[model samples]
Target: MKLSDFELDVLQLFWQHGDCSAKQIHEWVCETKPSAYTTVKTIVDRLEDKGAIKRVGKDGRAFVFQTQISKDDLTPSILPSFVKRFFAGNASSLITHLIDDEKLSDDELEYLENYLAKKKKSKS
Candidate 1:
């Protein structure tokens, strides 16, 4: 299930804050994007249609929504295409970019090393 940038932004709200009404989402979005209420509602409606979110109940006249899909659910589907596009379908290139170009704290680098070690150990 591919999502547009706008859809991802809206989904992030649900993931971060749990269930909320379109108006509530609009208010939060407006803080950054200056989007209109109807625009935000349209995105919410699209998300509901896509099964990323569902109508849980009503908040007064507006419908309340909760996320059906998770960040984890979307990442595996999105990452392969992203890697294919930018890294020539090589996942190692992506990991290399993260290690070299992206900022990683010492603890984070240690964690990644440990994770790789465990993965190697499992294979062995």
Candidate 2:
């Protein structure tokens, strides 16, 4: 399912925090940027409509929400389109850019190398 940036942001909170009320989400989002509670609520409502989140329970008067989708569920669907749009569908180019241009630590680079080795071994 397609999601707006704000919807994804809200869903991320659910994914990270497990279950949360709208008030909690609004407060967390406000730490980075100023936003009205109603704005956060609207985004939460939209996420529910998209089936990205579900109302799990209630805390006082507020409705608690949980993620209906995992990052694994969403990323595979989004990545191809993202790579196509930004890297002309060349995944190797995208990986090259990330490895060469981005600042990766020694451990991170080692992990990627090991992962690639395993992938190659699996293919053979």
Candidate 3:
């Protein structure tokens, strides 16, 4: 499902926190950027409409929500389009840019090497 950046942001919170109310979401969002509670509520409503999240229960007067989709399920669908738009559909270019430009620690680099080795071994 196509989601606006704000919707994705809100959806991520549900994935991370498991279940939350709109007021909690708004407070979390406000930590990084100022957002009106109504704006967050509207995004939450949109997410529910998109089936990305569902009302699970309630916290006081607020409706609580949880993610209907897993991050793993969502990433594959989004990654291809992201790579196409930014890296001209070249997955290798995306990986290369990240390895070259990003500050990956030794442990992270080792993990990537091990993952690549396993991937290559599986293909052969």
Candidate 4:
């Protein structure tokens, strides 16, 4: 499912905290920056509408939420669109940007290399 930046941010919080109310998610989000409670709730509602999250329960008159879709589940679905939009559909350009502009550390590079190697082996 396509999520806006705000929706994705909220999802990350749900993933981290597990099932939680919109108020709890809002509180967590507000730690980083100030935003209206309604705004956060609106994002959460949108997430529900998109089927990215499900109503897990309720707490003190507020609905609790949990993820229906994982970040991994969303990755392949969104990646090609991202490549097209941001990287002009160039895989090499995406890799180059990550390596150069993203300033990935040696450890991260090694990890990604190992991951790529494993994928290549699996394909072969």
Candidate 5:
């Protein structure tokens, strides 16, 4: 199922906090982007409609919800479209962009180098 940015944000909260009520999710979200409680609740409801989350229990009169899907579940589906839109559908361009735009620490660079070497060795 497709999710809007707001829905994705809400889903991420579910992934981070496990099960949570809409009020709790709103509080967390408000730390970064101030939004109304109703607004957060609306996004949560939309996420439920998309089947990305399910109501697992309740807290008082409020429903407690958790993600039905993992972050991994959505990343593969979303990445190709993201690449197509921003990187012209070329993964190498995406890699180059990351390399150029982001700072890679020595350890991070070594890890990536090792990962690439392993990938190359597997292909050979």
Candidate 6:
């Protein structure tokens, strides 16, 4: 399911914090930037409509919600568009850019090496 940018932001919090009410999400969102409760609620509503989230319970007058989708689901759905838009669909170029431009710690590089080795072994 495609999610708007705002919807993705709200879903991020949902995934980060687990199940929470709209009021709880609003409070957390506002801590980063000023947004009215209703606006946040609207984003949450859209997420529900997209099947990314759903009402699971209630807290007082507020409805509590949880994610129906996952970050893994979101990543695969969005990755194609990202590759098309930014890398012109060339995965090698994307990897090159990331390896060259994006900072990687020693641990991260080692992890990637191990991951690649595992894939190589599986392919053989």
Show where candidate 1 strays beyond 4 Å. Answer: none
What's the residue-level lDDT of 51 in candidate 4? 94
Candidate 6 per-residue C-alpha lDDT over 1-124 given as tens digits, one digit per residue, 9 for 90 to 100: 7777778889999989999999999999999889999999899988888888999988888899999988887898888888888999988888899999979999999999999999999999
lDDT of 2 by residue, 66-124 (tens): 88899999999889998999999999999999889989999998999999999999999
Model 2 shows how many backbone clashes? 0
Output the worst ten-in-a-row residue range by lDDT, candidate 1. 95-104
* Candidate 3 vs 4: which has more lDDT: 3
Q: What lDDT would candidate 2 get against the real structure?
A: 0.92
Residue-wise lDDT of candidate 1 within 1-124, one digit each (tens)?
9888899999999999999999999999998999989999999999999999999999899899999998999999989998999999999999998889979999998999999999999999
Which wins on lDDT, candidate 2 or candidate 4? Answer: 2
Q: Cα lDDT of all candidates, in order?
A: 0.94, 0.92, 0.91, 0.91, 0.91, 0.90
Worst ten in a row by lDDT for model 5:
1-10
Model 4 CA lDDT for position 73: 96
Runs off by more than 4 Å, candidate 2:
none
Per candidate, the number of residue pairs that clash is 0, 0, 0, 0, 0, 0
Query: lDDT tens digits, residues 1-124, model 4?
Result: 7788788899999889999999999899999989999999999999999999999778889888889998899999889988999989998899988788887889998999999999999999
Q: What is the lDDT of residue 69 in candidate 1?
A: 90
Q: Superpose all Cα atoms of candidate 4 onto the true structure and report the RMSD in Å to 1 decimal.
A: 2.4
Worst 10 residues of 4 by lDDT: 96-105
In TM-score terms, candidate 5 sits at 0.89
Q: Pick the candidate with the highest lDDT.
A: 1
**Candidate 1 backbone collisions, by pair:** none
Q: For residues 38-103, could you state the per-residue lDDT of candidate 3 as single tens digits?
A: 999999999999998889898888898988899888898899999999999999999999999999
